[model samples]
Target chain A: MKKLNFGIISYAHPHALRYASTIAQSRRAKLCAISGDGANSDVAKGEAKKYGAKFYKNYEDLLKNKNVEAVYIAIETYRHKEVAIRAAEEGKHILLEKPIALTLEDADEVIKAAEKNDVKLMLPFNPRFTEPLIKAKGMIKAGEIGALEYIHAISENVKPPIFLQGLDMSWFLDINKSGGGGFMDTAPHGIDSLLWLTKSVPKKVFADIGAKIYGFPVDDIGTAVLEFKNGILAVLTAGWGNPKGYSYGLEIKYYLVGREGFLDVRTAYPDFTVYQDRAEKIYWDRPDVRGIVGSFVTAVLKDKDVPISGEDAKKNLAIILAAYESSRKGKVVHIDL
Target chain B: MKELKIGVVGCGNIFNLAHKPALKNIESIKVIACADIDGERAREGAKAFNAKAFQSLDEFLDLDFDVVEVLTPTYAHAEIAIKALKAGKHVIVEKPIALTTEEAEKMVQTAEKEELKLFVGHVRRFDKRWVQMKDVIRKRNILPMHIRKREVQNLPFPAHYWYWDENKSGGVALDLGVHVTDFLRWFFESEPLEVLGTGKAIKEEAKSNDTFDHFIMVVKFEGGKTGIAEVSWAYPYPSRYGVFYHHVDIIGKNGRIRYTPLDTPVVGVAKANFEMPRFSPLLSTFPDAFERELRHFFECIKKDIEPKVTAEDALIALEIAEKAKESARKGEVVRL
Candidate 1:
């Protein structure tokens, strides 16, 4: 049981901390090193010490480390391709944060780089690890609900990244860096879950994307209606449209209607509200992040295929890009992929 | 004190559930006669109101009624309303004034020529909750960025029922879609600029020449505002009667408001089922709104004022719905 030594590059994205914690707590993986953003090197150094991992000022330096077997790239979305290509060139298995890259061409090049280097590329979509949804997918496939007819999914956040406390996530509001605000950053998870559960491809998409609540340059709210090739119609509304008082950090809901029966799925089910003098917090009982990290580690260690491949994520990205195009042109755009 | 004698046509579900309950509370309006193609239903409805029953439209039109309530199927709305107007009677047709814009326009023209009142039942205008939502947006100067209204009806009718036929019911787009588009137009206070729609028939077995059982319509207003209207009649299985789910979510620059039945303080729990008791928090209590709408109609007739929901408003909603149907068929955006 050889433990995979993992290095995390750039703490710009908050999910980097969760990945670091999961690696440190896992039995078959170790947090070998961490690289910080140039402006926030001290915070990364503190985090590296907390996880008992070495720290590097530059992400390239962490990539150069001989002991690091795989790298979790959690930089800004704009730099995903560059760092992921570099990590692949370093002969390290890569677990890239979602969207794969900003555009389809960049995503294809990243996939090519991973294949050319013979390193595993995995995209961590935590919703794919949800237990009830996994069961629901099985039931749907098993003809428990009959043929699936329609799907209504909602993946909403209370506010944009800029409104996040303690950390400055304003890069998400910049169109150049994050591509789009809420739809780009928050919608991929639901899209990925839909792609994974249904195992179908979207043929056409009509979308309404705009900045509704917060007047950011990037769109904060978007809703896409997709018709899949399997005759399943899915309508997903994703973005920062929920109120600030919504305690659930990420509210993901799905309603699946079939010929015989229907299912209502809430990923954050079995959660409880804890009210205190400081703040009210909702604690979800599902340890989905740990599931994602553990499965990725096992896939790398056993030389097995990753649960969610880059190609699968690229398809999800295609649906998202098509949605943006549909919104811009005010027409139903056919997905080329 | 009954000043207006009302003759009702069509004794279907809507008549028994909405108009009947509403007409009960209006003291100024009297139901003098009832007409239906089915003699039994006509007799039953007439008995309920202690009014005379007529199996022929001509015989019913010959009666001395001041107002005609066209509660029949959507496709028959134009003919019945125009005939009622030509016979010197004010007409109050249910939502979706007609299946086509031309038919609706003819009805409007007939009303103008006859100098008779013609009201379209855009009942949400009188619903206290929706009216209050409009008030909040207006008084607070809230600019709505996106609004979503959804309606799901689990119709208990079999596959061969006329409601499933596009010719008679005008499908879900003209049937349920009109209610939402009209509400969105009223909420935004703007005309629809364009619409993109996608629809499908979830049930494999249904009688329809054309038209889907479910439709998702996106309307862009004159401003940058966006409205999403979703209507579904394709429930997998049927309940004893039926089931209805309606929800409204408004996202504005100033604030957000969500009105859903899940927030109701009332619930019904039986042996194996727990339900919201009411099909919709807005509609289950809609008898009050229906009463208000009827009272408004009576007041307009008495005071010589224009009705709140004019035939023009219903025409605009139908136009949007027709464009949505075209968009759904062509898989493209249809501009108004």
Candidate 2:
């Protein structure tokens, strides 16, 4: 079988190294090249050297390399559209990092570009690949939890050390680059998961986004209440400025209140447990689910539909953008997409 | 016409703490009978309060009582309160009104049809500290209110006692939450427009499926002012020997008023010379606010006026509680 050649566009994203490492370990794909600028380029080169892959200083050069059939765009949020469009134009399949683009127009541009080139465009939302979440979706589909009524998702860090260091990241701290801070960053995963499992789009969103702490230019904490088209309501909270040295955990609790009973999945830090009628019956430990890279490779080799598509990714981004607009305008924003 | 006869239900921790002492203190109220699912509990309560022991609800209702105190497991609050009201008895039910909003509404309807006073035991409303705080807020017109209540789990009861079950107790928010919700409604003088909350069950082997030991809720009222209520059973450390310390701060158009019972100082005289010294009270557990609530219920019955904590008030608090739980469950704001 011909190995799928994969390269990364930038190492600035925290997940970039993981993508590089996953490619290095995967049997279906080979790490082809890495592209970045200055310090990021050096880091990417060092990572490439460690992984025995080529490193390119400019993203354009990496895109032009015929050996790299697919490019994973892990650049800054602002650069996603330009790199994704360029990669698509160069006939390379693209796996773009979340917040598909900072603006709806840029997201639309990337979508148009991918469609125009007839190449695959995947948005990496690794949580979908986690075994427990997979099991949860299956249970919901099989009527294990019955009709889904409510979903409560929480992503919390005991306190990350990042807040102790002054909030000084340019892209992260700026509203223009990051779109919004915590909501734009962590919430998209939950939003996409809700949409995926429920197979529904949000009808309306009410959000409260602001810097509750860590007085930064961008909102470090965000809470959103969404009313889905199916009458299912979801609440999502994201915070970046927790106390230092605390374990980071993501929990999604689905309250599937059925005609007969209820099914709940409480996804703790490392394990996800399913409760049938309030009695926990199944437990899956899925610490090894490398959701981002796993899905990217699965799409390339297995021809499986990418768990997160460009349109789905854009919808999540639109929800976040709507949240921002709601917070600023102090009114509920009707989600059109 | 005759002294209002009352039957005490569920002679458990709250009965011992509040009901026995308060009933002993109040005039025009007689503890005619006592009942508990546990015979020993009924006997203990009867012995403590100098009342007759009735082993079951049937026997308790047979007694000539004008009011029944529904203090059993939260799940039974609705059923028993409705039965008592239908049997021509005023009902003073415990907080959380009922396990679910549907049940609470039914209880309210039964009470209204029977022309009986359905007083929800939101003792915090009658607590000396909370009463003083409410008085200040009402007089000062505090617009935006922030109230927080914290408690370290000294001894957690068995989870089977309805309070721990999400379906029965409505989780921690409904258990300890009704107090804060009722407080906000009373303070704001309006129903909650919306509620957003987050909660989690921390104990690994917790018997009850309701997981959250900590809960935080943000309630928006009709007039644009927001009230935040934080309740937790997972306090990490011990404090000044008080069972629970409640702090409330009401932010208004003019000024902010902060109140904590811990701040109240006790005056004492020294034996040495004639020196008067000020020392804070040890903050012992006062009698349950249940007694005051019950007394108010009796007074309202005599005066032909509505009780302060009416069925509607209880229903409103229960509505807020349910919305907060929904918010915690869905991770979204529930609009009332």
Candidate 3:
């Protein structure tokens, strides 16, 4: 089979940098077009040339490229729906980044557009693919614990002023664009994983979010509680002031307390730790994105069930949307479904 | 060797774990009496240290002791320490010295008039790491360190439960926050110029105190340098209490130094006892800090010299902590 040709939407997100390098080395996919609006186009021009692809200043031009079969939508999270809907309308397969949109209504618009045109929509939901969590999901299903009761997942980073200024795109802290602070940017790793591990849809959410230290317009620290349809209670936390690196302390921890027993996973440990004069960093085995990228490419190639689907993508964002609403309203917001 | 007969007041967790154990390490210091409002706890402490038990403070003060360890709650520190000092006893009280700046000031004045050696247990100053850190700071001038101290217990501590009363303990700000606040000031030897802070009583178990079990304070010193201390005790999830943790990092003009769990040199799979402050008191272990602090306190008494951590220094620490609490309560910067 001819390699499934892939085009990347933008170079805005940090993940896109990794994906651009990985997609070039992929056996099943060929990098075709790299396009977005912004100063990123100049960077994308060189990036596209290296991968034997063209750089389109406009994202729509990339979407119209006949040779590009699927698209990797790696733009700022708030701009997800607008680009995704256009990509879907062009009948392009999409592996959109987490937080498909700022609001569930916008998420719905992208979902309906994909259904109307028939395209595969996959969400990175990265932590779910980690070995420990995959095993935890199997254990929960095998009655290692009777049933899911509560999940506490947290993600923390040290984003001091110097750290934030270092990032080329600080859009993640922009309230209007990112919708919230680190909660909207980083919480999806745990939020999406919690929903996937428990296999439950969220019903209601209550949140306490704040900009405790940096005093950003939106919250850099927050904890949210989600009540799922299966009577599971989940506590989610994402913060940007951890006093160390992005994955400091326990990094991504999932504490699952079921009826019989509990299971805990801290992704940072058992990995090599390196220290600098000023700070330390952790070295872990990078995810075999073959499962994520290859599966999406293969599914698009064989016309089979995509590993992640359009509808499956919306569940996590619904909870995230409800959490933001709950925080704003100072009360639990019920999920529309 | 000039043997010091010590009387320990308030047979609390710190007394049983730190003071009694520390006194035992120094052969020159004999603990003569252990006192508490509750005779049972006092007896328990006395038996461990081979000292007499006294339920009355006056009766306990009559013991043949030359030194007193004011290990009681924050509210009683001023009275007990002052009485001990006025009676011509050299005193080595725990951190904060007293709850208020006024009370601490009086304690300092009384100790000065009596010409007695008075030290507050800012034990970190004795830790080899911090001692060496000070030497480094003297030469290089480390500035703007982010110091965080977190103590998480499995809860229901101080079987006597006096700590639950804000009037008695001043919650965490005066209780645990003082140690960090005191040490931050000690590093620079600079007076606290202003403080802006925030505290929370988010734990339902701590509701009776109506005060915070958590605090994050930013202190600005006279040299335009700053320090942020985040101290909390509200972690309840068993996994979070995996280990009692403390971290201090001083980023210097030339270099930096840090203390973290990674520095412990010992990590075993022992079962964690869900009790006061931590699964185990890491700082109290020999060669850590407590033993060093006690040795320093006794050596100062033998030489008839001022101890490294003096009552006046601790009084300044109390002043800073009170200002931080005020800042937190009023939502404004409290200028000293």
TM-score of each: 0.94, 0.59, 0.63
C-alpha lDDT of all candidate models, in order? 0.82, 0.68, 0.70
* Native contacts kept, each candidate: 0.42, 0.00, 0.00
Candidates in descending TM-score order? 1, 3, 2
Backbone clash pairs for candidate 1 read none
DockQ of each: 0.41, 0.04, 0.05
lDDT of 1 by residue, B1-336 (tens): 347999999998789888998897887778999999999999999998899999999999999989999999888899999999999999999988998999999999999999999999888889898899898888987778888898876666676776787878778888889999999999888889999888888765443445588789989997688898988887543445355677787878876777765441111111113333454332434677888988898889878898778889999999999999999888899999
**Candidate 2 structure quality by residue, lDDT tens digits, A185-298:** 777877877888778898878776665445566666566667788866566656553333222233333333332223344443253345445322222433333556666677
Provide the TM-score of the second chain in candidate 1: 0.92
Encode model 2's per-residue lDDT on B1-336: one tens digit a residue: 678888988887667766777888888878888999999999988886688998878878877878898877788898899889888888887777888889989988887788777888777777777788678766766544333333223124555555566666667777777777888888777768888776645443232554776566777776545566656554321222224535464544333455543331121111123222222222223565656777887898878897667778878888888888887677556888
Candidate 1 whole-model C-alpha lDDT, 0 to 1: 0.82
Indicate the TM-score of model 2: 0.59
Q: Across residues A76-125, which tens digit of lDDT does each residue of candidate 3 receive?
A: 77788889999998889989987788777888898888878988888887
For each model, chain A TM-score?
0.95, 0.87, 0.90
Q: What CA RMSD would candidate 2 show? A: 14.1
lDDT of 1 at B168: 82
Q: What does candidate 1's lDDT look like per residue over A202-261, in tens digits?
A: 999999898877778889899898889888888888898766555554677676777766
Best by lDDT: 1
